[model samples]
Target: MSGIKRTMIILPATLVYFLVMLDSSIISTAIPQITDEFNSLLDVGWYGSAYQLASSAFVPLAGKIYIFFPIKWSFIVFFTVFELGSALCGAAQSSPMLIVGRAIAGLGASGLMNGILTILAAILPPHKLPRVMGLNVALGQVGLACGPLIGGALTEYATWRWCFYINLPVGALVGALLLSLRIPEINTKPPAYEVLHTAMSSMDLFGLVLLWPSAIMFFLALQWGGNQYAWNSAMVIGLFVGAAITSGLFLTWEYHYGDNALLPFSMLRNRVIYSASATMFFFMGVMLTAYYYLPIYFQAVKGDSPLMSGVHILPSIISQVLVTMSTGTLIQRVGYYLPNVLTGTALASIAYGLYSTFSPSTSVGKWIGYQIIGGAGSGATSPGSYIAIQNSVPRAAIPTAMAILILCQNLGSAIFLTVAQSIFSNSLQNHLRTQAPGVDVQAVIQGGARMLRPLVPAQELPSVLQAYSRAIDAVMYLGAGLGVAAFGCAWGLGFKDIRKKGEEGK
Candidate 1:
């Protein structure tokens, strides 16, 4: 392909990838406004978790769809679904409706993310793939960095509804550009009814059926265990039991299905694939925890406005973006990812430990320095696992391996966010009672961090702030531990040099 033609094909796809990632955390800065508008502060966790759950659940299915259908058409379909979901979110009138919209958008996002990589794999040679993948990951990190800023600007200057509405025009334009592009069809299998049916059957819908509800149940149990109900309550216990049973059934079905399974045993058995997936799981958990909660700390504890909170997070965002782009290039040049992974996780752990020490009186310089440390670590390590897995797998296995990696990343965000939410709420409630005896805990929660100052009595404000600070500290501690665990997981990513592999195409 000519340079201009390649740009046209790659640019739109990268923008679409940016849109999906931007949506993942754009809501972080808007959470306060959303809670106040909907009067459902307790559902804050669900807003993010719903998107993650849907995205993670549909990843394998998306891989199968791409393998069996025309790449360009499959991508267009996914983009359309995403556009519809974005429209729904912009028009939602209630918290539940917004959550539903997020889930729908996530379903489409799963396909777009995997489809973009698959398309690139088809169009680019093995030697050129790393640079393109690196560029793609850098764009993704840029989206991650810019999300809060855009959300904050929209939420403060306009309405939070624009956060979703902004996607409509951009996505529509990108979709049009994608349709006009002449992408080569990677899958040329016969489209007869019988063949289509066979392809669908090979997707293992039963495994998806078993996996989806199990994951939902597990997240529900975690979301509600300490916040909505007692840990030992029948409601929580029943959800846990259901999740366990369904998870076991799903595993058994996948094992029996072997190569036909949504997540094939062959892919799972590869040391590099499994280890990289695990490393990504924990690394993402740590990254999202920081992204979501650091804003809360700034706004709630330090008393910054939404826009100011976004401004404060710039240290981390700038460092993360720069490191992520540079690291991607570095990996391509050096052709080894293990060192970057190790250094990133180590810095992340140290950064999280430092952040855990944040208090109301912590200086600006200290927080900014800590953010730089954490951001650089996260950025360097973010693309390492993906590169490792992509290098290790054959071209034919790229789709499945990519899906597995995406699943781990999304699942980690979902699971760890739930854990952090549970801890934050429980600790906040306990501290509120102990620190300010007469304050109403439910009112405090409903008001969120932004309104806490005005909601509580002036005399009790100090105690409430202290309680919030301590609760956030606990969350940071959890993040620190996750970072340490990610480091250990990276160690298991045994050395495999990609520079030595001969060029091969699917």
Candidate 2:
């Protein structure tokens, strides 16, 4: 395709991805309104996690569907499902209803990014893919980074329901645009019975069944381990044991299923894809941990309202948007992606180190600068994984590689959130016990971030505030550790220039 024709297809596809990702994190700022309306404080974890769990579990299946089916029609089906879920969320009268909506939406989202990148690979040449891939990721990051900002605005000025309702029109527009776009088509699928057989075999339904149980049991164990139940309690231990057994079973099934498995064992043996996945895993863990806890720092420690906290975090997301776009362009021009990865990881590490220094009364300028540093690092490296997938694999395998990369990103988010929350909770309780002995720690825990100041007496408020900042800093320290881990993984990418098909870069 000509450059202009390719750009036309890329724009609408990228917008779809942007909306998919925006919904993922936008709920962060609107949780207060959601909980207040439904009176379900206990279900807050499910609000975000349901979407994540469903999205993570269905991704491999989505990848298989994209391969066996036509991209355009497959995309339309997923988008329709996503739109239906959005409408359900906007009209939800109960917390569980909204959680169900989010899960449905996640089911739809599971395939959108994979399909978007797959379409781009089909239409664009290797030399130009990285720049546009970066652009797509940059836009997606904007949606994720600004989700809190947009959701908070809607929640404060309009209604939290608008946060989801907004997707309806945008999806409608993209749905129309997709009708006219041209993308590469796979081999002709057989008849209906053959399609059903493909779903059973190629889609690896048994592997998916095992995968969901394994992921859910594992996630529940992590989520409830130190918070709802003691880590060593029978419930938590049983969940972990269930997770391990199911996971082992899933692995055995995948190995037996061979090339047609959800995550093809043969495909993963590639050194580049394996190492690139690890790099993305660590990077995503850092991103989710930092993005999530920094907001808590703004709310619990800095005394910002949820809306104001979103405004305060804009410097970070804005910086990320700029850096991610430019990094892609730079890689296209210079021919090697490793330099950008190295630079971004180092800056993110530094950003975490700076975040660990936040106090109850950090200077405004200092916080803003720290956000910029963190955002830039994330932006610089975010596109590298996508670039790596296209560069290392044949075009036919792009969907599968994209699936693996995205699965890592989702898994990273889910696992890191569980770990960071534990770190924050344990550290806060320890601080409260030592620093503010007279305060009712359990009451503060139930009351949550917005309730802390109101729950504590004036004399103990300062100590409690300090405790919050220190606890948040402990989470930042975890982000710093992830940064170090990601930095090490990046070196394993083995230097390459996407623009030069036969050339390797040192």
Candidate 3:
């Protein structure tokens, strides 16, 4: 393909990715509004977790689907499903309805993201792939960074629903352009139901069944324990036990199914693939915890409006974008990724540690500087794992490898967010009891974070703010620990020079 043609194909696909990522991050700023509307502050984690759970569950299956189906049609179908889900979210009347909509959107997003990367892998030369992939990733980060700003503006000026509504037109345009473009297909099998059915049977649907419930049970256990039930209560314990048993069964099934498994054991054994996935799993957990909670700190604690909260997050976003763009070129020039990964995680650990020290009286300069350090670290390391996996795996395994990587990242987000929420809620409740015993815990929680100032008496506001600050700090401390673990995983990525392999076509 000519340069211009490649650009045309890549641009629309990147836009679609941007839309997917935007939907994921946009809800951060709108969480306060959504919780207030539904009167369910405890459901905050579910807003993001539901999406990540469904997306993580279906990602591997979507990779298998792309391997068997026409890539173009698969992408269009996924994009359409994503649009439908967004429409449902925009029209939702309750928190449960919105969670359901997010789940649906996540299902489609899993396919869309995986399909886009698979298409790129098929079309691009190995030597030039890093730069293009970098561009795609950078654009997605742009969407992620802008999500809070967009969501805040819409929520303040119009309604939180516009956060979902905005996806409609952008998605429509991207879908139309994709339809006009000819996306080359690597799957030469005939496009027939019989073929699809055979492929589907080989996809290990039973394993998917086992995996979904395991994840849902695990997240529910985390979300409900301490808040809705005692940690030792039968309900929470049962859920934990169920998750463990189901997960074990799922692994056994995957082992038996081997190549036909949802996540094939053969691929998992690859050092580069698994280590890189592990690195992303921990790194993303840290990155997403900060992304979701930083807005709350700005709006709920610092008294910024939603729009201003977005503005406050800009330092991190700008640093991330700049680092992401530069990291790609750096990787292309250096040919190795482990050093970048190590360096980035080291900085991330320090950043999160600094963030944990933020108090109600933290200065603007201090917060901005902290965010810049964290963002640069996160953006610099984010693409290393994906590039490493692609370089290590064969073309036929690219879809599966990418799917596994994405699955790990989303799972990290889902699991860690739930853990963070649990920590935040429990710590807040404990601090509130000690700091201001007369305040109603349930009432304060239901009133939502941003509404705390008006709901609490003036005398109690200080205590409430202090409790919130401590809760947020607890989460940040957890992020710092995860960053340390990510750094450890980075060392296991096996020191391969991706550019050298690309040049040799090995």
Candidate 4:
């Protein structure tokens, strides 16, 4: 590919990836409004779960599909499909329908991380890959960092539905730009029959069958356990057992079948890949858990409106964008990954620790400081992790390695939020019982609305609100603990700075 062609492909691909990522976090602050509008707080959990589950379930599958298809056309197919899903979400009238739409979008989005990476590797030299990947990472961070602010503004000034609707035009434009660019095409014809035969011979069909159920069951169990069902209830127990059994089978299958496997066990054998993937899992979990729950602390405990809550979270997003941009450019210049990883992780750990001290009485200045620390940490680590993983592997292993990284990330995110929320509930109940002896702690815990709204009697409202604040603080503290663990994992990352001109230049 020539300079202009490469620029066109990279720039547009970056934009599309950014928009998809933005969509993931954008609707969070609007959840309360959606729940209220639909009168289905019970179903709100599905909104996030549907997207996450679909993305996790199908991402690896997309990786396999890319083996038999052109990268350029595959992207066009997936991005268009994703845009269609987004449009459906914007037009959705019911909670279930919205979830279905989100799932469809997830299905398309499942392909994105791997898609861009594959394209970058094919066109760019090994050394230049990091800088391009860094650019991709920066674009994604831009989406993540800007999501809340954009979502909040849209939700506040117009409507929450616009959050999903907004993706349509952006996606279309990105797709158009990518399609118009004339890029070099690889001449290898996909050995579809042979690839399929090999895939069937080597792949674990049993594991594939078990994968979705295990994920779905585990997610549902988390959503319901403690919040909807008692931890020891028959329903929760059955779901948990099903998830464990299915997951065990999947693992066993993967272990037995290495190369022809859906998940290559040999890829996991790479020390650097293993360590980097594990670190990604831990931090992705911690970061996502915070994203899901932090706004609740602002809205439920601090009495901020949804739009205001989103606005409040904006600083962290903005700071992360700035940090990621600088980090990306520097990585292009530096040719190593360790310094950024160590520095970012150390800063993030401190930020998370500081955030754990949050209370209703915590000042705005203090909150901003905490967010800045965390944002900068995020900026440093996000690109740093991707660069490490991409740089460590050879071209042959790139797709599988990227797939594992994303899978670990999604699974970590799903597991952490479920576990974190469970921890929060158990702690909150204990705190409420001791503090408000006569209050209906169960009611307040189950529906947090009574604690949030002005409709509740003014006399008991203060105590209820106070309890809510304490509960929020406890969850934040718990998240902080998780973040500290993530930072420790981040510190373990072998940082090798790969500068823009390549490692040889340094």
Give the winner by lDDT: 3
Question: In terms of TM-score, how similar is model 3 to the real structure?
Answer: 0.98
Give a tens-digit lDDT track for model 3, residues 50-97: 888888999989988888778988899999989999999999999999
lDDT of 4 by residue, 1-506 (tens): 75877887888878887987787788777766676666554554566667767878877777666655677887788888788889999999988899899889888888887788777777777777766787788889888777766776787789988999998877768877887875443336455577667665543455577788989899889878877799899999999999999999888888887776768888888766766777777776656655666676787767777778877987788778888878867877766676777677677777767766777788999998788888888888887767777777776567667877787776676676556666666666777677666667656654543234644456766666666667656656656666666666665556555554364534
lDDT of 1 by residue, 1-506 (tens): 65888789999999998998898878888888888788877787788888888889999998887777778898999888888888899899999999999989988988998888887877776766777888898889888877887888888999888889999999979988998898875546457475467864677888999999999999999999988799999999999999999999999999999987999988999888888989988888898888888888988888887788888999999999999889877877887889999999999999999999988889989999999999999888888887787777777678888898888888988899888888988998999999989899899998877898889899988888889889999999999999999999898787766666624332
The number of clashing residue pairs in each candidate reads 0, 0, 0, 14
lDDT of 2 by residue, 425-451 (tens): 778889999999999888777676767
Better of 1 and 4 by lDDT: 1
Worst 10 residues of 4 by lDDT: 446-455
Compared with the true structure, the alpha-carbon lDDT of candidate 1 equals: 0.86
RMSD of 3: 1.3
* True-structure RMSD, every candidate: 1.6, 2.5, 1.3, 2.8
TM-score per prediction, in order, is 0.97, 0.94, 0.98, 0.91
Candidate 1 backbone collisions, by pair: none
Candidates in order have lDDT scores of 0.86, 0.83, 0.88, 0.73
